[model samples]
Target: MKYLIPLLFAASPVLADAPVVENITYSDGRFDVTLSHGDTGWDDYADGWRVELADGTVLGTRVLAHPHVNEQPFTRSSQIMVPDGVTQVFIRASDNVGGWADDTVPFSPN
Candidate 1:
C-alpha cells in the first residue's frame, strides 16, 4: 500500500541526532546558551531554540540560520524580559528533523 511505504520511511533514521545543551548562563534579564553535538555531526541540520517561563510560557525563540559545518561549538545569546517575581526559566532546542532538548535555570530578578 502507498501508506506502507511512507510509514516505513518515516520510521527509518535519516538525519543526525539533535544537539545538546552544553551550558547555560543567566544574568540581568538576559541569558546565554551553548549547544554541541553529542558524538554525532549535526552540521547539515537546521534548528530553532526557545526560552520559557516557569509556568510553561514562552519567552522567546531563535531560529538558527546557518549550518554548523565545523566541530567548533555553537553559542547563542538572547535578551529576554523575565516576569517580575519569577525565579526560574526553561529553555528548549528543537531541530527541523524532529528532535528536541530542554533545560531549566534558576534566577532572581533583583
Candidate 2:
C-alpha cells in the first residue's frame, strides 16, 4: 500500500496562503497590476480574487465562473483604466469557502 499512500498525498488539495499585489504600472493610458501569491496554483480559485482602490473603492474583482488551469508563476496581469488621482490600490482574494485577504500597493499616475 505504499503506492496508495503517495497517491493519496498527491490527490490532497493544496490550500494557497493568500494573494498580494506586488506592483502597479501606469503607462499609455492603461493600468497594469501584478499579483503574487504563495501558491501559483491559486489560479484555480481566481474567481475569488479582487482589486480595490484606496478609500474602500473596488476597482475590479475576479469572475472565474470556471476553474482556471494555468501552470505558471503565481501572478496575474490586468488592464484597467487609471483612476483619476488614485495613489494606491488594494488587491483582495477569497476562497468562496472562507473569508477574504487583501494587500495594498502604492503607485503614481503617469
TM-score of each: 0.68, 0.50
Off by over 4 Å in 2: 1-16, 38-44, 64-70, 96-99
Off by over 4 Å in 1: 1-15, 38-46, 99-110
lDDT of 1 by residue, 7-49 (tens): 9989997766666767777777677777665433354453667
For model 2, residues 4-107, the per-residue Cα lDDT tens digits are 99999899876665545566565664555455443334443444555576677777665434333452223444556657776566656654333376445556
Which residue window of length 10 is worst by lDDT in model 1?
A: 37-46
By summed lDDT, which 10 consecutive residues of candidate 2 come out lowest? 66-75
RMSD of candidates 1 onward, in order = 4.7, 6.5
Q: What is the RMSD, in Å, between candidate 2 and the native fold over all Cα?
A: 6.5
Give the count of colliding residue pairs in each prediction.
0, 0
* TM-score, structure 1 vs. true: 0.68
Error of 2 at 16 (Å): 4.3
Quantify all predictions' global Cα lDDT against the true fold.
Answer: 0.67, 0.54
